[model samples]
Target: MPVARLSPATLSAVRVTLPGLGVIAVAVALSLAVNRLVPAVSPLTGAVVLGVLVGNLPVLPESARPGLKWATRRFLRAGVVLLGVQLSVAQVLQLGGGMLLVVLVTVLTTFFGTVLLGRLLGLPRGLTLMVSTGFSICGASAVAAVEGIVEREESEVATAVGLVTLFGSVSMLVLPLLADGVELGMWAGASVHEVAQVVAAASPAGAAAVAAAVVVKLSRVVLLAPLAAGLSIAERRRRPAAEGGRPPLIPLFVLGFLAMVVVRSTELFPEAWVPMTKDVTGLLLAGALFGLGSGVRVRSLAKTGPKALVLGLGSTLLVTLVAYTGVRLLG
Candidate 1:
């Protein structure tokens, strides 16, 4: 009897990719559980930690590497694109002119400032770029988005992820204690690394603070595509003149993200579905981060030196001071 046979190409692709993807799926599930139980670190952040632990502990099977690579590149990009569903043009504009300026200035300053500091500290350009995105934008999501623009070793990516997650989580505890209500909210919205961390930090103040912080942080989130596109352009320009290739003004996935933002602005999606969409987006992002995390070598990242650490601390301080100044000036 004759039996159906899988094509060699298809079979080979699946053999290489499926195992790592399955591992990522499990990591995402674990992340969700941690999110529910712990409620401090974000599921995406948790997933990265989980991946790091698995990766550095000698448990990572070689068979899963191909899928991990696929997830880090493809899944991360797709997740960032889908994240746009949670934002809207109107939502950002409603923060008022002063708050808008604050968000814009904070992101730009933190981004460029970190890169310059990285140069001064002699950190690798690619690692600095990744860390800059994490600090200037929306933490891991921003790191994942910028990953498309700056090609680098996964170890660098992992290092950036670790720094942001550590600082972001710390801020959740420390920021609230520094101020109350609107003051704390403004500070956090403008300064905190991730949306989840912003919420956690600001919620202690009040619901009103949470509302303000979420809006402010989302404004930062809105900056992701533009910043990424700017990097892509700059990178293309910096290439040797002989290369002669002009990159797209925006990545296709970034364009998709912008489209999702527009769709969201129209308010066509049912309000009821927004929460569910956010959950799905978080899951996708978590799975991607887990894959990225599995590539981390803790010892290798350590050898890259304390320069990246200084950069992270400096970036964090820069944003915090800038955000506080904005809060005072704008008020």
Candidate 2:
């Protein structure tokens, strides 16, 4: 067998990449432990929290940043692609045309409405869009999905994630206490920020509620692809032709996402692979969030923080009301 040779550039990349990735791996382990100890504290959210904590610390090595960024890009794409495996076109269809309409309407309304609100607040469009995506769709994963296309500041991504975590946690605690189990389940599933947050909010109501919330939440997750496409087109048109090379109308990872959706729909993979896919996807996404968090500078963001926070509050309230209206009308 021929000896495998490593180029100078490849060696340099490996050297820099491994250190940051290793940092995220340790962070992921701690996040996983925290999730186990407190089931409601999702590993993905924990990963972002831990990353933010470590990132703000004064002594973190420069060598690790490249790997962390690598995780943000590579791992994020992989996670989004695998995210589709958790959904099926069949699951969405089972919701029937009316419930499907609810999902579609909720997404469209929240997305555009948040953009309008952000304009009125004079916040950056990127920050508003990321916030909108997180609230309107699936939370941090959704936040990260549109991040590249929006070309916003890293602080904005962290802000969006923070908003998702805060509002989602609050919704988890408060919704169940309203005393309508099944109805609340559909409503929370449609409106809640994160998947785990939805499940946590609904679990107290029992299994049927949990199932309803999850199906609705995953239905929302299905919209991520088209949302990416629409944003991409908008971004393309907004930019000058000479600004740079144009972004694709539909990103490659989105196509990968769609492909996995097909795989899940056709039962192309054995059911045994599902659990594995979930675990792998979870790890990659958690690590990716950690990477994204590392780029945020808390003090540096102080100026925009308040505006983003207010926008977040408005976006959350808006999505919640719209989703409740849909649930009530369609139920």
Clashes (backbone N, CA, C under 3 Å), per candidate, total 0, 0
lDDT of each: 0.87, 0.88
**Model 1: what TM-score?**
0.92
Off by over 4 Å in 1: 1-8, 241-248
| Best of the candidates, lDDT | 2
Q: Against the true structure, what is every candidate's RMSD? A: 2.8, 1.5
Lowest lDDT 10-residue stretch of candidate 1? 240-249
TM-score of each: 0.92, 0.95
Model 1 clash count equals 0
lDDT of 2: 0.88
Over the stretch 168-221, how does candidate 1's per-residue lDDT look in tens digits?
A: 888888898888988888789999998989999999889999999998999899
Q: How would you encode candidate 2's per-residue C-alpha lDDT over 284-313 as one tens digit per residue?
A: 999998988888888866778778878888
Q: Which candidate ranks first by TM-score, i.e. highest?
A: 2
